[model samples]
Structures are given as C-alpha cells and as structure tokens.
Target: MSGAAFETIASLVRTRAGIVLGADKAYMLDTRLGGLMRELSLASLDALAAKLRAPGSERLAAAVTEALTTNESFFFRDGKPFEHLKRVLPRIAAARGPAQKLRIFSAACSTGQEAYSIAMVAEQLGLLPRLEVLGTDLSQEVVRRAREGVYSQFEVQRGLPVQMLVKHFKQEAGQWRVSPALRAGVRFETGNLLADLRHLGNFDVIFCRNVLIYFDAPTKSRVLSALADRLAPDGVLYLGGAETVLGLTERFTIIEGERGVYAPVVRMAAAG
Candidate 1:
C-alpha cells in the first residue's frame, strides 16, 4: 500500500474507533485488510482504500474498522483484577440492601471471557442471585460469540481454573460450553467507548481494562470521563495495570491498596 492509502486507512480507523495506528502499524493494516480485500473481491490494498474513500461506504468502513480492531482477551486475564474483585464483592454486595441487583460492565470484552469470569466469581461467592454482568465490545462478531457461550479447549484453558471450568462448563464436541446457570443474567452488546454511553446505565463495577492504550491523549480523556459518568456513586472502575486516571481525569481516585481498582472522587471525599 502507498503512504497516502495507509494514512487514509489509519485515519478512518482512528476516527471511527478511537484506535491509533502509528506509522509502524502499516504492516498490520496490510495483513488485516489484505483478508478484507479478498473477501470484498478487491485486487489490492489500494483498491480497498479506494472503496473506503468512496462516499456512502459505511459498509466498507465498518469492515475495515472491525478488521483492524484488536480482539485479544482471555478468561481471568491478569490475576490481580480478579483477585481484587473476589476481595471486594462482599463489600459491594453489603453496600446494597437485600434483593438489589448489582451490575458489572466488562468494556471491550473480547469474546466475553472477562464478563463470564466475573459471573463465575459471583457464582462462587454465592452472589449470582443479585448480580448482572454486561459485556460490550466494538466487534459485533465477538459479541455474538459471547452470547453463544462456546469456547475452544484452548480458550477455556487460558486463565480459567480447572475447578471452575469443570463446574461452570461442559464439554461438547471438543469445545467447552458455559453452563446454563453460569450463562444466566449475563448479556453482551456491541458498543463504542468513544461514543455516547448514557444508554448503558450505571454500574457497580466497570472493567475497562487493557483498552485505553489504543487511544491518544484526547480520546483517552474523553473515554475516561464518559466512564466516570456511567459509574454509580460507589462504583469501582478497573483499568489496565498500565492505564490510570491520575493524569487523565480527577473524576476517579485509585482505591487504596488496590492495583487497578478506582472509585469516584466524590465518593472518596464523602467517605473521608
């Protein structure tokens, strides 16, 4: 692909999905979009870029965006976050009155493992009766797979404890399918973090981990602010270990003794 075509494709992805593609990512663009070209019957990357440049090419634009978006995820990814959650679930549950539902959002939930992991934790804690887990991602394909609750043996093996796997999943045709009880009360949706998120409602916990590294400063701040708005008064926000709100926004303050856990600054102030 020519420099101009690469720039155009990068710009389209950044504008549409808030994912930054630096000059070094040209190879990634070529490799990912190369498949799209074959699927669309386009002869070259330049031809695919031309389709993207055409007016009323929303379909092509979406295809490019989906093709470029990273969907890397695994069950119980990063032990610390899940460990913190296990420790804190009781506190979150205790804060609410009896029979009140607790909502958890797994933002950028690639293929639904993180959300289901949360469900598994809740189930182990005997909190599933009052818990609701929602997993959202930029890719509709992943969200659909998440809803299906099927995983290859390899996918189930990653970060999924053997005991939990045995209890929460059943082997079916060489793939592990989430148990009906474990699948209960968990939902998945396709959404963009950079867009309006008011419809997602407030959450007791928001797991927006490992996704902010893709955005530039302005977009990162915008997304963090939006997440702050969606957090309930005492809600906790879990960011990637490398991501932080310290320099991004004052709406959240890192929880003491927690690696990726945060609470609304106002809530911290009130408690103080």
Candidate 2:
C-alpha cells in the first residue's frame, strides 16, 4: 500500500471507528488481515489493505474495522466490577422501586461472555426478573454470536465459576449455550460509539470495558461523551480496570468504593 493510502485509511479508521493504528501495529494488522486477505484472493496484506482503500468498497471498510477490532471477553472479566455490582444491586433495586428494572449496555461485547456475566450476576442477585441487557458492537459477526448466546468450552472455562456455568449454560451438541430463560434477557446489535446513541435509550449502567485503551485521546473523549449521553441520569458507568473517567468528561463523578467505579451525575449542577 502507498504510504499516503495507509495514512489516509488509518486516519479515516481512527476518526470514524475510534481505532488507533500506530506503526508498530502494522505487524498486528497484517496478522489480523491474513484471513481476510486469503478470502479476498489477495496475495499480500499490503494489497488487501489497498483493496479496502479503494472507493466504493465502503462496506469493505466496515469489514476492515471489524478485523481490527479486538473482541477478547469472558464471564465476569476482572471480578471486581461484578463484585461491585453485587454490592450495589440491592441499593439500585431500592432506588428503582417496583420497576426494580435495570438496563446494562456491554459496549463491544465480543461473543457473549461479558454481557452474560452481567446476566448471571443479575440473576444471582435476583435482578433477572425485569432486566434489560443490550450488548452492542461495531462488528455484525460478533453481534450475531452474542445473540446466539453460545460459547466454546475454552471461552466458558475462563472467568466462569463451575456452579454458575452448570446453572446458566447447557451443553448442546458439544458447545455450551446459555439457557433460553437467561438468553432471552439479552439482545445484541451493531453500533458505533462515535455516532448518536439516542436510539439506545436510557440505561441504568453501561459497561464499556477494555475498549477505550485502543483509541487516542480525542476518540476517547468523543466515546466517553457519547456514552455519557446514553447513560441515564442516575445510572452508573463502568470502564475496564485500566481505564478511568480522568480527563475524559466532567459529566460523571467517580464513586470511591472498591477500587474506584463511576456514577453519572443525575444533575449537571451537582456534577460541577
């Protein structure tokens, strides 16, 4: 690929998809695109990259975006957040009254584990009855898999407790699939965090974990701002352990409990 073409595509990808591809990631991109290149009948990553750069292959850009997107997820990833959820579920339940309803958005939920982990926690905490779970991603392929609610044994093995695994997922033809009752509570869709999220409605909590680390500062700010908008007034926002609300937006106040989680300000006046 031409240097200009690589730079142009990288810029467009970073701006539109919030993906920061540095020079060191050239090897990573080649590795990730190998399958795509083979399927596209291209001889080289450079050629494949150039083909995706061609005009009228706009959908190809979406495919490339999907290729570059990382989707490593598992049940209750990093334990602490779910532990916090367990602690707060009852309090949030009381705040919610009869509705006792909860909305959770697992941004960039790969396959289904992270979102399902929330479902398991909700069920275990007795919040399953009226829960609404939305797991969104930029890739259609992963979204479809999340909707299926199926997982490989290796996927299930990581981060899942033995008893919960036995309770929540059932083996069907060798693959472990989340049960109907549990699966019904969750929905998956393709979405762009950089775009308007008004259609996603309000959510009591948003788990946008592990994703922001891949973006630059401006993209991070833009994503955090959009997430803030989709978040309900009293809702909480959760980021990956490595991520924080620091310097992103002033809309949220960090909740100082169990290693620093964030709660969105119900009132702008209070936030300031």
Candidate 3:
C-alpha cells in the first residue's frame, strides 16, 4: 500500500475508533478490507482510501471501521473473570433492594459470549430477574448476531463447557441457540467506546477486556477515565489480563487478591 493510502486508512480508524494502527499493521488493510474493496468495486487499497476521503462517504467510512475491528470472542473466555463475577454478584445483589436491577455492561462484547456468560452466571444463582446484562460492540454485524443468540458448533466448543452448553443452549439445525430465558436477560447494541456513553446509564460491573491494548497511551487513559465515570462507586471493572490502570489513570484501583478485577476509586468530599 502507498504511504498516503496507509496513513489515510490508519487515521480514519484511529479517529473513529480510538485504535492505534502502526506501520507494522499496514498489511492488515488488504487482508481485512479486501471484501469491502471488492464489493465496492474498488481495485486497490489506494482506491479505497480515495473513496474514503471523498465527502458524504459516511456509510463507506463506517464499513471500513467495522471491517478493521477484531470481533474475536467465545463463551467463558479466561475463566477467572467469570469465576470472580459469580462470587461477587450475589453480594452486590444482597445490598440492593429486591426490585433494583444490578446492571452489567460488557463493553466490546464481541459476538455476545461475554454478555451471555454473565447471564448464565446470573441464571445459575437465580438472580436473572434481578440483573441486566448489556453487551455493546462497534460492529453492527456482531451485535446483530449476538441479539439472535445462535452459535455455530465450532463456536460453542471454544471455551464453552459441555455442562453449561447443555444447561443453557438448545441445538437447532446443528447450531447452538441460547435459550430464550438466557436471551431475555441480556441485550446487545452497537456502540463506540470513545463516544458519549452517558445515555447508556451507569453500570455496577463493567467488563472492558482485551480492547484497550489496541489503543495508544492517551486513548487508554481517556477510556479508563470515561469508564470510571460510568462505573458506580462500588462497582468492579474487569480488564484483560495484560491491561492495567497503573499508569493510565488513578480513577480505579486493583482489587486485592483478584486478577483482572478493579474497583472504582471513591473521592471524598471536602468539608464545608
């Protein structure tokens, strides 16, 4: 790809999604955008870059951004996070009134596995009615699939235990479908982490795992601070094992004895 074309696409992605794409990932432009390019009848990355630069290409711009996003997901990914959630959810529920819902946000919840996993945990604890799980991703395609709640055989086998599979899913035409009961407890939507998210309201638990590693330092700190603002004072934030708040922001502190679990730092009000 030409340097100009590469920078154009890279800038679009970074500006729209807060993801930093370096020259090392320049090769991905072809591999990832080939279908979009062909579908639009564009001959090369340079051509696609030109189309993207043209005014009123909002739809094309969105398509390119979604194409570049990594939607990799599976049920119960990195077992420890779900384990800690199961232990903590009931306690959080006990502190609230019976009618109050404990909301959990699964940010960048690709294909809905992480959100459904939370639903399964809530179901197992008989807390489904008392809880709500909202999964959001930048790609409208994955969000649609997640709302439909169907998974291929290969998708189910990835990190999904047989027992949980049998308990929560029913096979239809050789694919696993999440039970209506489980589906009812969760919702999926298309969202951008860098955009204003206040309308989504606050969350008692936020799972924003694995996506931050793709961002630059300033973007990471910005996102962390935004996440802190959305988190309840007592809420827990789950980050990817490799991601941390140590250098990014002081809005969160690691939960002692927990891997990947963080608590929002409470600010004290000054005396009158």
Candidate 4:
C-alpha cells in the first residue's frame, strides 16, 4: 500500500471507530482487507482508497472500517475482572429494591464472551432473572455471531472453565452452543465507541476492556468521558490491564484495592 492509501484508510478508521493506525501497520491493509477487496472487486489498496473518496462510497467506507476492526475475544479473559464482578454484583443487588433490574454493558464485547461470562456469573449468583447484559461491537458480523450464541470448540476452550462450560454450553456438530438461559439474559448490537451512546442508558457496570489501547489520547479521553456519562453514580468501569484513565480524563477515579477497576468521580455541589 502507498503512503496515501494507508493514510486514507487509517483516517477513515480513526474517524469512524476511534482506532489509531500508525505507518508501521501499513502491511495490515493487505493482510486484513483481502476478503473485502475481493468482495468489492477492488484491485488494490489504492483503488479501495479511490472508491472511499467517491461521493457515493459511504457503504464501501463502512465495509472497510468493519473489516479492519479487531474482534479478538475469549471467555473470562484475564480472570480478575469477572472475579471483581462476582463481588460487586451482590453489593449492587443488595442496594437495589426487589423489583429493580441490574444492567451491565460490555463495550467492544467482540463475539459475546465477556457478556455471556457475565451472564454466567449472574446465574451462579442466582441473579440472572433480574439482570440484563448488553454486548456491543463496531463490527456487524461479530454482533451477528454474538447473537447466535454459538462457538467453535477452540473458542470455548480458551479461558473458559470446564465446569462452567459443561453447565452453560452443549456440544453440537463439533461446536458448542450457549444455553438459552444465558442467551436470554444477553443482547448484542453494533455500535461505535466514538458515537453518542446515550440511547443505551445507564449501566450498573461497564466492561470496556482491551479497547482503549488502539486510540490516541484525545480519543481515549472522549471515550472515557462518554463511559462516565452512561455509568450509574456507584457503577464500576473495568479496563484492560494495559489501559488506564491516568492523563486521559478526570471523570473517573481508581477503586482502591482493585486493579483495572474505576468508579465515576463524584462532584460536590457548591455551598449555599
């Protein structure tokens, strides 16, 4: 890919999905966009860029953006976040009245593992009936798969415990299908972190793990602020091990004794 071609695609991705691509990642264009190029009958990266520049190419641009979005995910990834979730859920439940429903949001949830893992935790705690787990990703294809609630054997084996697997999944034609009980507790949608998300409503907990590493500082700040807006006052936000809020935004403060856990900053009213 030429420098201009790379810049064109990178600009589109950054604008639409808040992902930053450096010149070193130019090779990814050829590697990741092969299927998209073939599907669109595009001859080269330069040609794709030209199409993206055309006035009627909004759909092509969206396709390219989706093609480049990362969808890597696995069940109970890194263990600690879900463990913290186990402790936090009951506390939140204790605070709520009998008729209230608890809500969780898994931003950039990839293929639904994180959301389903949350469902499993709620089920284990006997809170599934009163819980709602929403998984959102920028890629439409992954959202479809997440809604389908099916996974290959290799996908289920990664970071998923044996007992939980047996309890929540059943084998079908060499793949595992998530139980209807779990599926009923969760929903999936296509969304972009940079876009306005107020329609999703406030979440008691938000898992935006492993997503901010791809964004620049400004974009990171924007996303963190947006998350803070949608989080309940006492809600917790979980980030990736490498991602943090330091030097990003002041809308959140770290939860003491919890790694990668944050709570919204409480602003006091002025004295009369």
| Top TM-score prediction, candidate number | 3
Order the candidates by TM-score, highest first: 3, 4, 1, 2
Global Cα lDDT for candidate 3: 0.93
Return whichever of 1 and 2 wins on TM-score: 1
Global lDDT of each candidate: 0.89, 0.82, 0.93, 0.93
The 10-residue segment of model 2 with minimum total lDDT is 263-272
After superposition, the stretches of candidate 3 with alpha carbons farther than 4 Å from their true spots are none
lDDT for model 1? 0.89
Per-prediction tally of clashes: 0, 0, 0, 0
In candidate 2, what are the lDDT values of residues 76-130, reduced to their tens digit? 8899999988887677777887765688898888887888888898898877887
Candidate numbers, best lDDT first, in rank order: 3, 4, 1, 2
Error of 3 at 41 (Å): 1.8
User: What 10-residue stretch in candidate 4 is worst by lDDT?
Assistant: 1-10
Per-prediction TM-score, please?
A: 0.96, 0.93, 0.98, 0.97
Residue pairs in candidate 1 whose N, alpha carbon or C atoms collide under 3 angstroms: none
Q: Tell me the tens digit of each residue's lDDT in model 3 across 1-272.
A: 79999999999999999989999998888999999988999999999999989999899999999999999999999999999999989888988888999999999988999999999999889999877898999999999999999999999999988999999999999999999998988998999999988988999999999999999999999999999999989889999999899999999999999888999999998889
- Say what the RMSD of model 3 is: 0.9
